[model samples]
Target chain A: MSGVLTISQPGNSVVTDLGRFRGPRYGLPVNGALDQFSARAANILAGNEDNDPLIEITALDFRLRTDTDILVAVTGAPVTLSVGGRTCPQWEPVSVRAGETLAVRGMTGGLRAYLAVHGSVAAPVLLGSCAPDTVVGFGLKLAEGTQLEVRRSVAPIRQPYFDLPLFRLGLSRPEFGTELVVDVTDGPDIDEFGDSAGLLFSSSFTVSGRSNHIGLRLGGELPERQSSAELLSRGVPVGAVEVPSRDELLVLHRGRGVTAGYPVLAVVTSMSLDILAQARPGHTVTFRRTTVAEAAGALRTATRQLENLRAAVTTVFGLLGIGAQPQWHDLAPAVGS
Target chain B: MPVNAAAIEVHESGDSALRVVAVDADREANWTTVHRLAEWLESSGADGVYGAVPTYDSVLVEFDARSTSARQVKAFVQLGLRQLGHADTQVRAPREFDVPVVYGGEYGPDLERVAGQQGLSTEDVVRLHCAGSYVIRCLGAPAGSPMMDGPGFPLPVPRLKDPRLSVPAGAVAVAGRQAVIAPATAPGGWCVIGQTPLTLLNLANEPLVPYMPGDRLSFIPVPAADFGGYAGRYLEPAR
Candidate 1:
């Protein structure tokens, strides 16, 4: 029920989970998957729970050798998957034989990729999650010679060629590019900037090098606030677009601190968070204003689509008599039990 | 009488969260309202309420958009405020702590500079710093890093124009009318005054953060040798 994965080549990657949602209560950031949709899709394809621990491969050259047979799915940033020199399809469940090396390389169109195995990757869970928060020194980073313990014995699920369409349909394939139009809702401090708030939507910004899970610092026209009054520190949620000292625009991300002193002019919509996650350092972005109702509607639609995908995938697995582990059973229970 | 709906402004932060801000100009009143609202939210066990983080003047209530809307969360906060009334809620007797520190040495490189700026001796600066009973306004920047507001110095101790690349953990620093202990080594603009040996955050403990908002803190100068022993004795097992 346990297998060891030895890291032969660990690209810039970290072990991540759904992230610690309750982290803010302790003044800690919610450290989790940057692209949650892709992470969950990988988990569903791997027949594991959506919240199960997975590897977030940031750099392209990630390689690992499994000591035992295991089922795994690689999603997010389009990457070439290979096992012992044999090319394998991304976003589909692939069984790696014992002593075989799985290589993920030539990443394109995105900044991160997710690798989810059956059952879950066993790691030390601090504060209810295994996602790495480098700021707090929590969780582990994949490196060469690192050993990853994955629990659960996976049985290979065979599928006919006709089932490929259904499997492909269930997989999440996000278009990655340099220019992105991110949707945002009015922030708590939107009025602080007065007329300058309009500039946020009109101006284009380039993602600066100072970008990480904590925030995506944008280099663009500085938006000035009307008043120079000292504002009190307040809770800053994920996707907060904060303008600190009229220097640069910073969009807080999953690993953002609980509170920030700067005024937030807008918050990125939940639907566009996945697109923002794929933005690279040189990526250009423009904020598109959206109503809260519209943003919420879009999020609901995205969520419903994911639910439908999960149901379709579950049905396909059931028809094939594949006893795939129920990851997100809220959509549909595993039928072939 | 209706909790002065005008006194509290509920603003939407994104589609899923609402930022409840007390419009009181008085800092203490604002914090008091936020703290009480946070307590009510925590105790009410409201469904779809993820959690509420109390800041200096506001509380951000995060909710599950799939289950609840921002408007619903605002109504919940308003209802909680109405039940509590306009008068400030009874402030609980804050838990007091005697934090031991070693000042004016390698631990506090800027101690001499701070004392010089205030036209006081290093000993006088330490005395003035330890004299006041500081209240923990909030825990921020990092986990368990308490931002305590205390008595103002003889002269305003402005933050470093150029922040240090890193300040060691447990380093006591002051900026404006506030003093804070570094929870972990981080780049900060606060002027370093001293260093404390006390552990503010320990994951091994049941309650990760040793102190919370509204706690009272006082510093006691101890020799470097006595720090280790004093910390071991003062450090309480997380509840």
Candidate 2:
């Protein structure tokens, strides 16, 4: 028999609640599970595939209810997690019986968190996804009294021990004090700025409060065109820093619209989004120039590290006599070329 | 990557993907070619293609490096392009939608201001707006903000020098030669002429947004009294 697990946040959690609409809708942007990495990690701990649907909590305010014992893991945004109204350690597997309530009191710094259960949530799918599009009214934004049915799927014998992510994959450790240097490449409007435009990388910018899932408005040196040219409206890539007429730097986010006409400066690397997603409204953000080759290298290293983490978790769990599946498979499929 | 290929420019976009740009203008001329290539690769049951989002002018095809290599997908795309000269079908046909708007009242607080700036009466502004049919030029400024272009009014009205932090949803705004309706309550800088009760977006609907690129749109002057009856249907059903 299938039981239920319901989790929710107190208020709007941008990445946590914003997911793709699982209903009929073409324009609804998928806004769910911000830290895909952590979500996958939590799923692995539950002996579930990386793609298992889970609840992403922001700034605490999460409660898990069940009629049967369910294996779960909490990850992302160092939140003080409690089960049945009692404090417990996070980033590890915890089993909860029926009627147990899990709550995240608050967060240390990061803005979003992920809660994974042993089975998928019973939410309708739109565009082949179970995520919600809150802004566009697509899917369920776990409000009060949202009941999520959990299937009693076969649980893997081995479960991986969950740990926090590293600097590249997790929150920035103040000790790492390694300034978050985001690498960017030229954009369609890159040449719009004079040679001084290249100087943009040499300067620092602060994240403005106006930032949102749509885009990040950066404050600092503005890039301009050498001569005013009306750019034909075209598709904008994520991370593309667009300079609208106001001269404010609008860094496009993952959910940015398809087309735009603003003068673009550069696009941030994918690795930087992890940091960008966590950046508060007024965090210092700096851009560093990188060649196409360098960007490829960075991506390669990041992908490899992620693969290694999945492998490590698998190895650790296998040693525990639990035959947990590899976690990386949760994201992209593992098809041989 | 494959035989019968033109020059291709590649850029590393992020830690997970690379962008291969095809140099072309005349967006209309390339739509079929781009769509055909993207569709062929996706339908080929090829591995590594994870996130492939197609847009008006380009297609961003992402893949997992572990499962597929860029060179592999590039070669596959090149193979499909060799047949680009063959007969093909269109992607999505352009559609026409008539949007009803209520002008010059509590629904549109700035209607008087816009009329004053344009040297036209509030009624005259409505006449001009309804008289012209607009083309969907682009969608931007905010998500789902449709930028339509047509024969603009005789006098150019400037946008509010100050943008409202939160304009009501379904706001019908005009700036220069363009006009649009906001899909959500968002900060806007356009001159608000009125608001529409029509929901341009509904998550529960098959297509989140009712309008598409190249869709022709016309603004119908709607009465404020009839708004309440039509408002809920336009929005997604309350879950």
Candidate 3:
């Protein structure tokens, strides 16, 4: 099958072969399918491990092509999807016949969308990850004329529906005009913002357009600082909320500089990574200080739920006499019927 | 009235993560101690420590909190600080890296301005910069950028009032008392003097970034004409 996927924002979109470079050195930061859990869920529905590389579409406009029949599923953001010009339901595995093109247009639920092929798209592996970081020019972004190798062998299965947890599908119901509550863990600079900063700790913040893969530039009341001395450069982590000014909040992302000189007020917890990934620019983001114990508990619960989903998938396919083993070959194309 | 001691000083950022505060304000001693502690944790392989990150004056130790206790991790950090008190800072030599740069012209659009701001000739600026052996204070900026310390000239130049939307890769910038090399093209505010040919930050690499906080840097100047030659050299391995 032959298809074409074009990006409205060439600077905004990319089509990368799986795993081109080793780590995050592909010019841009690794900005793939933001909702990784849902990306994995799409794979599981196709009888694959959640790790397979899928089409991570930003603002949709992704198209799939194949000469033969294929099975596919859409996860993450809900989009107006069609296969050979026929409408279909989302989050369900749909199979298509040969020479059919599947197209996904503009987002309806979230900012990003993902399309998983029956057999995983063939891309080179770098540092054991197929995800592409266009910033550093590591992995490839999906683009027109980007020829990907797909396994020709088709083992078609007629599965009715996928029984995955709604949360696992990463369906986000974004509340526009409201501050997004992100859980935070205090940082070394937490105490630097004096008693008034404590007021900040208790207050909320709004995500500004300045937010990007590097970090979120937050606009809010500055946390009080006990000392005004400049800081030395140090490392930062994903989801870190660092206030460099009296009224500025910078929330770090995955590509946050290894080190920073700004005093971090708090860090966004991992439990909220999927949620943070779904956040659009200019969205209001607020912080609620959670107890360490509560944070740990939430992480454990998320991990457990992830494992349970994997187990459920295994059981369902196992009973059907299918190997059900996690394989790249099980994923279908993004444009599914 | 008895003031209840500051609440055990614990906060949450993420569900699976926790950050321990060593110092709240900017204290040179505190920052150094934090770095020393970070170095210790990285080498010790303490339980639950995913990575120890140091910023201006504090260090952030990230852990799988689920696999390890925050209290235990804090205790480990305390122990590392105590150990730093006795460790010889001079025993281990710093990592040395040589970064080549293409000075002036398009590669360094702001070089003339930077030199003029320093009240020196373009050649004098390069000479002053290359004359000294610099030490890496940190890898600030974006994930792979390096912040180094070199000899201060006549005066400490201020940062760009408004940061550039996109600073080219290998950018050699100066602000206040520090000189830094931008590994990748990201927005920056420092006064640009030249552009380096080194790709300091590559997430694809094993260590993600090649330079470290305690590393030493030597800047080698290359003519603008030779920029293409050097750029080609670095691209060889990338391809």
Candidate 3, residue A210: how far the Cα is off, in Å: 3.8
User: What local distance difference test score does each model get?
Assistant: 0.80, 0.61, 0.61
Identify the superior model by TM-score, candidate 1 or candidate 3: 1
Interface RMSD of each: 1.4, 4.7, 4.9
Residue-level lDDT tens digits of model 3 in A247-329: 67777776555555666677777666556666776676667777667777776766566566667655655665344444223
Candidate 1, residue A192: how far the Cα is off, in Å: 1.8
Model 3 Cα displacement at B39 (Å)?
5.7
Clashes of each: 0, 27, 69
TM-score of chain A of each: 0.90, 0.78, 0.77
Reference contacts preserved by each model: 0.68, 0.22, 0.45
Report how far residue A20 has shifted in candidate 3, in Å.
13
Candidate 2 lDDT for residue B151: 34
In order, the B-chain TM-scores come to 0.88, 0.68, 0.78
- Per-residue lDDT of B59-99 in model 3, one digit per residue for the tens? 55667665776777767766665566665554345777777
lDDT of 2 by residue, A142-226 (tens): 7666666665533323224553321122322221122456678776456668786865787888878888767888888776667
**C-alpha displacement of B212 in model 2, angstroms?**
3.2
User: DockQ for model 3?
Assistant: 0.32
The candidate scoring highest on TM-score is 1
